[model samples]
Target chain A: MPDLLPENTPFAIARYTPDELKAALRKMYLIRKFEEGAEESYTRGLIHGTMHLSIGQEASAVGACMALGDADKITSTHRGHGHCVAKGADVSRMFAEFFGKESGYCRGRGGSMHIADVEKGNLGANGIVGGGLPIAVGAALSAKRLGTGAVTVCFFGDGANNEGAFHEALNMAAIWKLPVVFVCENNKYGMSTSTERSTAVRRIATRADAYAMPGVTVDGNDFSAVSEAMDAAVARARAGEGPSLVESMTYRWRGHSKSDRNRYRSKEEIADWMARDPITRMADMLVEHGIATREEIAGLEAGADREIAEAIEFAKTGENPKVAEVTRDVYTEAVQ
Target chain B: MNMDAGTLARPEQETRELSYAEAIREAMDIALAADERVVLMGEDIGVYGGAFQVTGDLVHKYGTDRVIDTPISELGGAGVAVGAAMTGLRPIFEFQFSDFATLAMEQIVNQAAKVRYMLGGAVSVPVVMRMPAGSGTGAAAQHSQSLEAWFAHVPGLKVVQPSTPEDAKGLLLAALEDPDPVLIFEHKLLYKMKGEVPAGHYLTPIGKAAIRRKGTDLTIVATSIMVHKALEAAQTLAGEGIEAEVVDLRTIRPIDRETVLGSVRKTSRLLCVYEGVKTLGIGAEISAMVAESDAFDYLDAPIVRLGGAECPIPYNPDLERAAVPQVPDILQAARALAGERV
Candidate 1:
């Protein structure tokens, strides 16, 4: 694919070292390859149910998660594989969950849309639009009340801005000065409706003004821009400066889901976004900055491919849950 | 044994008389005082003392931080409570009226009820939602509603309706101690009824039924305000030479199947009464439980359920009174079920 931006356009440098950049690149590549493998599995009937993929929005997920501490929390959207991988979820277990295996994160119950890793401070991925916003606020409240010094990052889409939950959670977070960062991935369309058609505000970030919080918009495809914005938001939250809205202007390279026809947008629009692929942009940046050679970047892709292949194999070999134990874990006996 | 009875006296334990609303407030007070992670959130709860003053003086005692006054956003507050519970805090969320719960069903039903099971028990939402329910204040259709059946129908939720001050305190304490989401429906009419409540830190074990009055002719299973009415009807039935048993169903979801079945086996007749609408209500579940259980063989007559009318609770006093079952309705139903009159 041809590079979309002009040469010598000043590629913003990410603050991470060469080794850390490689790790981030590997994570982004893993997310992309995992989604591709999931799509293939769906076609083969190995993975049941539909999934929302974040093909071109990998930079926002990795960049934002990189700015958070290990103890920090995040609530992700339906298109959450990128966030999960970026936040250090095991690929094998994630695949097992998607394949509905008993050894999965949710023990084969939560499939893709509901995978959660509580020990890693990931509350869970929600199927409802704007569902995670208030949950993030609650986590922030817990952090504040317990004095955990941890912040929560809430990841959502442009469509979620229209939900009443978005407004309510934002207002609550602002009033209490809860330690949370609202990350909106403006991927152009919510399902099939474009942002311009559905959202009243021109920019989703600007809605933060009504809630009395600072709002920032950045080039979501640029890792440096997303990272810098996220860093500022996280710092503000950790310092108890309340919540901030960070809108990442991004796009999805694939259709909304497997059932979607490419009738909403033109093929040219898809090609344009594909050309500005986040992984490719990072690779070019690494090469230009003399951080890594083309061969080293190629090696990262090979590593990611091998890892995803292993994960798929593990998912295929995993056991199915027994029918007799279906009713277990509905409620914890801890407080009973 | 008769001679030693006067000499062998026990020390008197401290007891106090409190209203149902005060007992609920005391339960929260004890919980908040006992646990630092316990917090209260609702509209007008802090300075306004809650919509019904059930949370009176709690804001003063716990300060505004623990007794939080949230904006009038049921969906947002409930979602926040669920999120907080998932994290660490044991938040008690109050809905001003049970009717307002319809606005917050997404958070309560989808998130709170399904999160633990969906996540394979990776997390537990120990959130308590207290809703003042039922009619009698002339609040009409919007404010007056008995929505305990709605939450009871959900699997991961524990639904309880406290009819007396003591159960109100004990059940709320137990709900706070519960690991999953618990919905407590406090009948609005019973909020002022006085009763003797035990002092400090007690739990009325959830999922158990209390046999208020025992008899041989018939069994009356009732919940919330109907429990009081059932007891009254039982007293009147005794004067007419028909003995009736009254069982107070404290928790709705767990259903106290053993207690209900045991009662039916002894009486051979069952009458389910509740304040909610009759069709597909809690009574329906109880009736179905009896019909499916081994107690079905002991039934001498058809099981009857006396519930609220199909219409909305009207603003007029007479219509509202006619909407739900009263003492006279219970007596009449018991009389006919006991084969005393047609």
Candidate 2:
């Protein structure tokens, strides 16, 4: 039995309504279900090439996104399905992207990774690991220059934390005092190698001191904790206090890519992580707090299941682009 | 020692000649003073007065912010320039040499070229990338290649390779004002060739080719420092009864195809000269265009291609001259193609 409540604790979990907690849980479950469907589809050859699934990192994505306003943006990584879902990318179009359909956001030009909608405040998902950092810097610069209050959140994995681009972008952001949040989803491992082995430091956030920015570590499995950390970062950026780095200590349940066989971890490690499942944790919290019953949660899950099935059906019917599109969008050709 | 020494000293043709480096400095001064948005950026560009002294005293005059000395990241600089262009700034990014462009190919080709279109034409990138190109300075294999042909292949890119001080000033101005990304290739050798450039704000259009000399025997198309060599060769060809017209294809991408074809129609013979290698060089593109057009039958001789040898641009001066077409080589190629000399 988990301890119900401790008298003296580190920091109190900020007050979240039962419905809000339930919504976060639903969002995490939606991301999980969507990614699982994508993984199975790729295995069955319905999807082409490679797909990066954010199966276990859903809480960090959902909670952080929930902290942002509609105008604030979130730049994604190659493992971007969770971020896309959390940022409200159209399910059918995202599905169509994997389906290699003309109706896709980039017309099948940018498959799973590069779905972008500036209007939705979701700067396109990047194929390069640390590529989003500079773009987010640019967006933050624009926001600062234009005097718009919008802030940008750049999301990347632990592997990208070592890239030169990451350091360069953060330095620029720090100097300019740009309104941005640098989120490092440290899922213990980068592809197959553990972050502890790859990174020289214990925590990814510790490196933020080099750039003169505030750094924080959060339990990414807990939605409220992630939300609290993100809220502070976002508020600091919006207040023009420069960028902050949030190291979300999370885990990925699946292998790196759809082709990964998961030979890196033991069964005990997998079960221990499963015991800390984000969606089930939030649901359990909601029920224990008298927020909602199990029947309502079950119905919401069923609704998401139906909607996702329909989205997949609609995406499968989408057509691939004409072969001649290869020449298009390379540049603004007709213009001088 | 002349009968009228003052009159001799005041010849109309003796206009003030300036080096290409001086001309570029003057252009930067004029552009920065004219437009508040124009800023110069590169490694060692500011207080260092630029790597080749092209931006002499610019940082002192314009301050450190306007004359930015960037860190040693080509990708970061180019990427920042793209973002800056999207904003209100008109950035003039300097590649230390043409060789470093490969490091920032994605930013140059993908982001800078595609941003406006990717955003449904919501923005424009008025970015200028000035690169020092070509061999003869003995900068070695990595830094001595002429890569104008590479950027010219991109659609949204404008390429300018100025032969003289006048064109360097005019083209730099035009590139700053143009709404697209323009690449200016300043040849390593031409930086010291003095010629009178018009004072104040001047511009040469991005698409027009300049006809250096008018004649009727053969149309010699050249670029960069080769333009001057072709002019000298044309004068030599005139002595051999081969009146060669010189056409400087200044802009390679929006290549002055019309000017070359029109000149070929009048001259009846054509020769393409460049410093890059002969295999699949810009010469081949010129040859194919001539052959595919109505001008093919008008050839007095097979279209002569006086290009650099198909080898790395060697550091040896004699080998370098032999590699690319020089004045004597151009003279020989012109006269022979005109059926006047073997």
Candidate 3:
């Protein structure tokens, strides 16, 4: 269990102790397994509404969240299951939400699209593109105003880069010197349109230059690389140096949503990304770095699979919301 | 309708004559002084004293931290206000013109209104938005609009169009105390109109109608600027031996059904007036409410609705005057309803 890597190794891998490294790898597996279980349940018609899966982007979700704690907050995107699992949410409750159960995160009102754990500082996953940008800036504003010293990370897609909210939110965060990190999970395609076809800049990170903040692009599949970029950005924000943008270059193995026909891209393109599976890469890295043996990695995978299986059972057994209480919670009855 | 109105100031409470704009500013000033959590955000709301001067000198008093001047980004600024409200800060966002609300509808309607419900009441957006609404100053089609109907159509939102200074100050203070998103549409023409306002904190309960004048012949139900016009028409109707009751529907949503129905039952004739477009507007809702209730059986004649012309507010002063329901328009409608003609 001794540290086998040299000092010149990436800061993320080098700085983490053996136990922390294994925990990080475990989360990547849990995120992958959670989405896989959700997809299987969806096919079996257990979930009513549609869901957006983050199958190939587990590393970006887990690595960006490595620096966050209960005090820190994150505003997620439509493809946000991985981010939710990465942020320490109970997968059982998430599956309960997908099953439209009363014990779900939103009491079955918000299905797959809007699960939130405010106690854990997950400000809910947004269904709108670029919807969470300004909200993240607002959360950061609260952090600075209340002197809580908490930072907010905004996870968005490549398509959201073109939204007016993206420009406006980035500008406000920069000018206010608020504690926030803009994490763009660029998966090459916004539905069927590629970044090359839709965006003016080659890299989504380059758009951050216009807002006068530091911007960087990293290999999203590489856990150490993504973690290292997020760590620096989170540190800068916590120190009150204002916000920064980090674009994680990854790809979605599946279509945008359940409705997508997969006619936009080739099977070869999908197979190519599958070959570079982030989970497999992370598992191999742990073995090569001597942090965990092959058998230990297998134990983590099996453990995640077991947890997902139990989560589905918990979701299926949870009670359905009352038909009469459908109109409740439209407005908070409690006076502040 | 939910809480008692804070009208008729107590014997110990003092009053002063202030314009509607000044009343709104006083309410904001009182809220900022009372609560450290309260913050104001808008375009040119700082040293500029706000586009309508409703936030006059507040920036100097509260500084930039509390009286924030956001960039020309309504959507982003509104979203910030919503986020701040959700995370323990009370933000009073100002849209320069009510027309600008269209730009920020996504944040207002989707995020602020639905946040608590979407999150299963885990969060409440205690955000208040002030919009200088209605047309009269010839700002033309773009700047001049009575779009409260749009917000009223959405359930999670509370819409109030305060027609007087007293309601303006009291309703804003009340909105700050409420745990939901509230939109206050202060008519552009009413900003300078002065009235006796209570000196300190008082809440004119949301979802209540005020009886400006009582009569026996017919009921004139109105909103915003039309409330004033309806009162003027009531006076003229009284001289014509027609007793007309004037009901100021201060709150657009949660439409004070009991007050309106009781008035219609007493008077037996209803004239619905508002400044929004004639089709699918506040007037239509009032008319439909009366028709659906027992008040329908009490009616002496068919209900009449007088609203804005089915067109954008024109640039011409004469045409602008003709666009919305003026005093004469209300007078004619009230007289016809009182005449007992079918």
Best by TM-score: 3
Candidate 3 residue pairs in clash (backbone atoms < 3 Å): none
Q: Which CAPRI tier for candidate 3?
A: medium
Tens digits of per-residue lDDT, candidate 2, B175-201, equal 988887899999988887777766677
What TM-score does candidate 2 reach? 0.83
Candidate 1: tens digits of C-alpha lDDT, residues A1-336: 115545653334535767988888889999999999988999899998999989999999999898776699999999988899898899899999999999899999898999878778888999999888888999999999999999999999998999999999999999999999999999999999999899988999999999999999999998878888998899999999999999999998888887899789999999999999999998988898777899999999999999999999999999999998788778786322
Chain A fold similarity by TM-score, each prediction: 0.95, 0.93, 0.97
Give one digit per residue, the lDDT tens place, for model 3 in A126-214: 99998999999999988888899999999999999999999999999999999999999999999999898999999989988899999
lDDT (10s digit) by residue, model 1, range B59-159: 98999999999999999999999999999999999999989999999898889999998998899999999999999899999998888998998889999
User: In candidate 1 chain B, where is summed lDDT lowest over 10 consecutive residues?
Assistant: B1-10
Worst 10 residues of 3 chain A by lDDT: A1-10
Query: What would the per-residue lDDT of candidate 2 be over residues A1-336, giving only the tens digit for each residue?
Result: 124545432221334555666776777778888987888788788988887888888889988887676687777888888898888777877888778787776677777877665557776677777777776776676677667788889999999998877888788788778899999999887888988789999989999999999999999887767887888899899999999999998888887886678888887887888789878876776676566799988976877787678889988899887886655554444533
Q: DockQ of every model listed?
A: 0.64, 0.20, 0.62
**Best DockQ goes to which candidate?**
1
lDDT for model 3, please.
Answer: 0.90
Note the residue pairs that clash in candidate 2: none
In candidate 3, which residue ranges exceed 4 Å CA deviation?
A1-5, A334-336, B1-12
Alpha carbon lDDT of each predicted model = 0.90, 0.79, 0.90
